[model samples]
Structure formats: C-alpha cells, structure tokens
Target: MTSLFVDRRGVVLELESGAIVFRENGERIGTVPIAPLSRVFLRGDVKLPAALLGKLGEQGVGVVILSGRIGRPSLLLARPHNDAVRRVAQIRLSFDEPFCLQIGKTLIERKLTRQIEWFTELRENDMQVRYELSHALRALEEHWPRIGHASSAASLRGVEGSAAARYFSGLQAVVPNSLHFSGRNRRPPRDPFNALLSLTYTLLHSEIAIALYGAGFDPYVGFYHRLAFGRESLASDLLEPLRPLADQFALALIRKKVLEKDHFSTTEAGCLLGKAGRTRYYAAYGEHSETLRKGINQEIEWLTAQVNEIMATAEDDVRSEDDFEDFG
Candidate 1:
C-alpha cells in the first residue's frame, strides 16, 4: 500500500474519479488512486475536505496531519481496535506496578543497546571522537542496570533523559560542526539539527500510532508514558527503541551533504528546512522509513504477544497465591 505525502502548500485535496485529486486555484494539478493508499501525510497548509476524509476513513486509511510543522501529529484513524478484552487487559496491566516497570526497563534497555551498537559500528576517522563514542558506549551499558532498577516511571524517565544526553553528546562528535548540535532539544528545537530530529521523531510517532491501532491496541493508552491530554502515549512508548533510526537519517543528511546549511531557514518559530530541502528530505526519509517499516510491524506484533503473556502469567501467579493462602 502506498503512503501519500502532500507537502506542497495551498493544495486542496478532493475526491474525483475514484482518486484523490489535488486542486490549485480551481485548476487540476495531480491525482492518486485512493484504492492503493494505506496512509496519507498532509504537511503544512494543505486542505482536506470532509468527503475526501470520509473516503479515507471508509477505506481504513490512516491520515496524519502535521500542523505547525513540528511536534506530534493529528492522526486520523478508523474506529478503535476490536479487541475489548485485550484493551481492558492493557489498561489493567498499565497500572500493574511490577509489570509496567518491568516492561519499561526492557524498552529503555533495548534503546540503550541500540545506541551502543551504533557508536561501535560508526566508521568515523576522528580518533578523538571515536574514543569518546567508545566511552559513551560503556556509559550506556552502565545505564542499563540503572534503568532496570528504576522503581517508578518518573525515575525511569530520568534515566532515559540522562541516556539521551549521553547518546547525543557522542552523536555531536560525528555530525558536521555547522549544525552546532550539542544535545537533544524539542518543543521548538533551537538549531537545524534538533529541528530535523524533532520532525523525524514526530513522523515516527505517527507511524507507530497507526501500527498500534492496526494491531488492536489503543495508541492513547500506554504502560510507560503518563496519560496526557491528546497525547498518544503508547506510540511514544514504542518509539523509544527506534529513535536511533531517526538520528541515523538526520546524521546521514548532514554528514553526507545531501542537505547543507543553505537548505534550512530560521524564523521566530524555529529552524526548519526549506521547500526544496524538505522535498529531498521526504524522498530520503521515505526510503529510510520503508526499511524501518518491517521492524516496526514486528516490534508491535511482539509487544502484543508479550502483553497477553505477561497478563496471563500475572493472573496465574495471583491464583496460586490465593490457593496457598487458602491451604494455610
């Protein structure tokens, strides 16, 4: 299935001839067959009418609108996953302290392991940077136990934050100096590199949300991320392991010179890629995203099985405990 991305400004989408057509100044511009599309990304100033939206909804195609060019997306999904029992189990298990913390530890450790592997495999020629990355690799391995032992979500998040600072610091050593990226920043990322990171992570968030929805899970509810207004916390939870993928693309774009400083513009809002740069970025990002798609689906499928298994095991342990108490 195809994923449609409409990044052009001032384009209106409408339904015509069983296809989604783009219009500009009341003139036909382009069209795509709606039948093959599984997802749509509307970025920056594009309009989508109700009829077109309705058709997408009917076809079970997810829509993600990138409003204001950053942060989380406005995702349009079909009705909720059909598994009420699993949904209830997920909600209950989220509140299960032992279970949630255990799962959180696994997620954080997986991410840190990926970070270590990345630095180890980096083909940097700078001896100094390589030495620092080697040190960071050891530091990330040390943090794994700290994450596993975290007693609360707040504590777990704190560990994750420290790991990010450590990870990006090592990353800063490899990227071009012109980007001036020191560490991770979001909610109006101050520099071009951080802005690119934010954009890519948001895109990852949208994809994971759609995948979770397709896998019969509620994207809004999560085990690790605290419930918040309008936040798809479960998607954030899943995105932890794959953040390095976004980092990989951002570094490739800068280090490989696919994008340069001239391709970006800064405004009062923040740094952002220009139209042409964004087009190139979308093409590059699309390919990278395709490679990650297989992993995303596999991870979600595995998480679904893990959730069911853990809940069942927890229930069995409780029953055994009650039996022992009754016998005593």
Candidate 2:
C-alpha cells in the first residue's frame, strides 16, 4: 500500500464507493482507491467530511494532519494491533536497566555505522570533499568502539550526539555553498538545509510511530531515549538507524536544487518552507516513501523479535526458579 498526500487548499474529500473523491469548488477533481492506501497526509486548508474519516478508520487507514506554519502533525490512527502481550513485554523491557543499556548500545552502534558508511561513500566519490568527509569518518570511527563501552544511557546519548555533530559537519561540506548550511539546528530550524532536515525527520518519525502502533508496540516507551512528555521515545529510538537516510534525502533535495532558497521564507518563527516548495517536497518524498516504509517495517520486525526473545527468556528463568524451589 502507498500513502496519499493532499496538500491543495480548499479541496474537499469524500468517500464514494470505496474511493476517496477529491472536489474543489463543488467540481470533482480526482479520486483514489482507498484499498491501495495505507495512510493519508492532509495539509493546509483541505476539507473532508466526518463520514470520510469514519470510513478511513474502518478501512484501517491512518491519517496524518499537518498543521501550522511548520506543519506539526496530528495523527488519526487506525485500530492498533489487538495483542496486548507485546506491549506488556515492551513495558517490562523498558524497566530492565541492563536490557535497556544493551538496546541503547545496539542502536547507537547501528547509527554510527550507517553514518560512517555514508561518509565513506562520499569520500570515495568526491575528492574535493575528502578532507571534510575523512575527518567526519574518523570521528565516527572513534565513537564506534565507545558505543559498546558506554555504561549508561546518558553516556550512550553523549556518544551519539558527538557522532551526529561530526556527521552533520561532513554533510555541511557536501551541500551547495549557496544553501548556507552550517551544522544541525532545529526547533524552528534557522537555515534552509536545517528546515528540510527537520521536515524530513518529522515525516520519518511519524512513519515509524504509525508502524509501531500497528505492530502493538508502545511508541512512547523506548529503551534508548528516556521517557519525556509528548515524545514518542520508541519511535525516536527506532528512527535512529534510519536518520542517515532521511539526512541523505534532505541533502539530495538541496544538492539537486529540487529545493532552493526561493522555496523558503523567514519570519519571527524562523525559516519555513512555502506552499510551492512543500508541494514539490511532498512529490519528491512520495518517490522515496515506499523504500523508507520498508526499512522502518524491517526495524519494527527486529524489535518485535527482540522483545519476544527477552520475554521468553524471562519466563524460562522463572520456571527454572519454581522447579528449584519445589525440588528443595
């Protein structure tokens, strides 16, 4: 299944015979079969009947509404997985300090490895950027062994943050000079490159959160990222390995000039992508969504297996203890 992105202003959506009909000014514009859609992203002034939302929920289609200047998202999810056992196991694992640390180490290791791989790829391809990419690669390589040595989540996060700084520095060198990208900055990203990164990361996070919810995992209870109010920590954890991919997508957009300086405007709220830029951005993103989703699903499957293995081990240990007590 694919995702449907509706960004047009003043468009009305209706459910007509198992298809989503798009109308503007009372004239039919387009229609899409709901059967082929896994999710729908609605942005700006799009209108849709309440009945259509009901139909979407009934069909197990997730809805993501992007609002405000920066397009903060609000998720209207379908019915989550019926199995609560996996959620219970996840909660149990979250409290297991040793398990959490191991998971954190694994996540950081994977992330740093991917970042190093990307820099290595760039270093091999472009001689002009070699100096910068080599430096970043060395920094990431230094952090790789540290992930296994990290004693706590706090230390692991520190290693990850340092690696990310180096990665972004390498990225800054590769992007066009006109883009004016320095290092990574967010929460109202100050630069066009940062804006694109923030937007792409948000979409990636949303995709992972939806996948986690569908697979019966608690998105908020993460092993690596500490619990925070309103944060999908598990999704944050799962997205770590894939962040380089998102970063690459943003870089590609800037480097290829699919997104340019003219596509952005700055206000007191900081740099923001205009509607025209977003239209092009979404189109480009659609081309990559399938691959992104497939990667996310693979991660989710890995996490599910890990949780099940941990739960099974715990149960076996309990049974062994009970047998020992009875024998005594």
Candidate 3:
C-alpha cells in the first residue's frame, strides 16, 4: 500500500520517471514506487503538478488535496470505480427488515455500553448522578428487545436518538464549563473540544465510507440513521461501533487540557478550530482510530475462534465450552 505523506508546510508533489517525489526547501526526502502507493494526501498549501494528472490516473494512485483543516479533504484525484451492480445488491440486502433491525439494535447497545464506561471514568461531583446515568443506560438495555422490534428505519432512529439524548445530557453535566451543546453543526463545531471531536469523527466517517465503497457495499440505505440528501447512510450505519472511540477522544482532550479555549475561535457563523487545534486533534484522532481498530479486530478474532470451536464440537457430537458464549 502507498503510505500517506502529510506535508505540514507546503511541498511540491511531482511524478518523475517511475517514482513519486516529494520535494520541499530544495530537498528531496521521500520517494515511492508509483505502483505501490494507493493515495497521497496533501494537507498543506502545496502545489500539485497538473501535468502529472494523466499519469496518476494511469498508475491508479490518488492525490487528495486538503483545504484549511488537515482533517478535511478538499480535492481528490483518482479514477472513479463503477460498482453499480454491487450497490444495488447491497441496497437490497440493507432493506432486509429483520436483519437490519437486529444489527441496528446491536450497534446501539454496544455504543450505549461504551458511553456508560466513559461516564464512569469521568470526574463528576455527584457519584449518584453517575449511578443514575448507569441506571438509565441499563434501562435502555433492558428494553432492548422492545426497541429491537422497531419495524421501520424511522422508528429505530427515534429509539437511538432517545438513548443518545439521555447519554449526552449526563455527559454535559460532567464537563467543567458548559460546552453549549445545543445541536450538531457541520460547518464548524460549537466548542473547542467538540470541534475536534466533530472533525475527527467526520474524517473517520468519510474514511469508513470509502472503505465500504471499495468493499462493494452500498454507501446509501441505512438502518438507524435517516435518509438525507447526499448522505452516506451506510457509513453512518457502520459508524455506531466507533462513536465511543470519538467520545473518548473528546474526554481525553478536555481532561488533559490539550485543547484550550484559545485553540478555538468563534466566528459569526459558529466555532472554528485554529491551526494548533487541528494539529492536536489529528494526533488524538490517529491514536483513537488505532485503539478502536485493535479492539474491533480482537472482537472479530474472538468470534472467529468461537465459530471454529462450534464447528469442531458439532463434528464430535458434543457442545464446546465456547458454545456458551453469546456473541450478540
């Protein structure tokens, strides 16, 4: 795979002969074989050699230009892949009511459990308040069977939103100063840490969407999240398991004071994270994504082991110890 090269200070990217060259300050530091690289991400105000665009397409390498924030991608250069047939198939499967509901229920339950864990790790004045939050979360879990029976995407979304409201409300009380958590805004985040969290999650969501698209899954047609114009519904569907990861990142930034008020500047529109804020956020986001990737990979490994154990035990006409494990 081609590794991502980020130029904090603007650099020049040029495809020379059989190698990709990254040049800055009259120095050549990085070179990669054209065939091995998948994507080159330009995070700074760098110049791309427009003459090499045709060759980049032929080499199947993507050059993505980011504007303003390191976390946001502005322009992407790559030959688009056509997967209309797979998208149709995935969309059809997404509408399998029973399957979609079950997956949605599992996703929400996992997120809520992690949210509870995060609260327990916070420094709150009233411990009973934490207990109450836990109780509310447990209430949602206990009623999962009922929520699982939601027939439509709209109904399931209501259940998810209700659970999030309870979770975020308890979370808001724990923060030292009020974050002004009125609602979610995409343009700019309202608070410093929130902005970081939003930027990280949006990038995460887009990355996941690209992976899903590459894997031939429909980027539209979701179970819990609503269908909106130009929204990648399927990516939103898959992001549930990772929401807690983003939540934990936000908590760490606030607790460590890595993200200060000065890191954020308020505009007439909303809050905008400064350059320093973006740097801190990108580092934190990288750590969080790695952690979640390992955790989820471990979960999958355990499931695979259980599956093998089950098959072997059944072959021997006996129940294995792993058979007692309830993956769901």
Predicted structure with the largest lDDT when compared to the true one:
2
TM-score of each: 0.89, 0.96, 0.70
- The global Cα lDDT (0 to 1) of model 2 is 0.88
Model 2 C-alpha lDDT per residue in residues 73-137, reported as the tens digit of each score: 88888888999999999998899999999888887787787788888998999999999999888
- Error in Å for residue 107 of model 3: 2.5
lDDT values of the candidates? 0.82, 0.88, 0.62
* lDDT score at residue 163, model 2, on the 0-100 scale: 84
lDDT of 3: 0.62
* Best prediction by TM-score: 2
lDDT by residue (86-145, candidate 1, tens digit) is 777888778887877777788888888778878888835567587878877777777877
lDDT for residue 283 in candidate 2, whole number 0-100: 89
Regions of candidate 3 where Cα sits further than 4 Å from its true position: 1-10, 16-20, 25-41, 50-88, 121-143, 178-187, 221-223, 294-328
Return the clash pairs for model 1, or none. none
Looking at candidate 1, the ten consecutive residues that score lowest on lDDT are: 123-132
lDDT at 248, model 3: 71
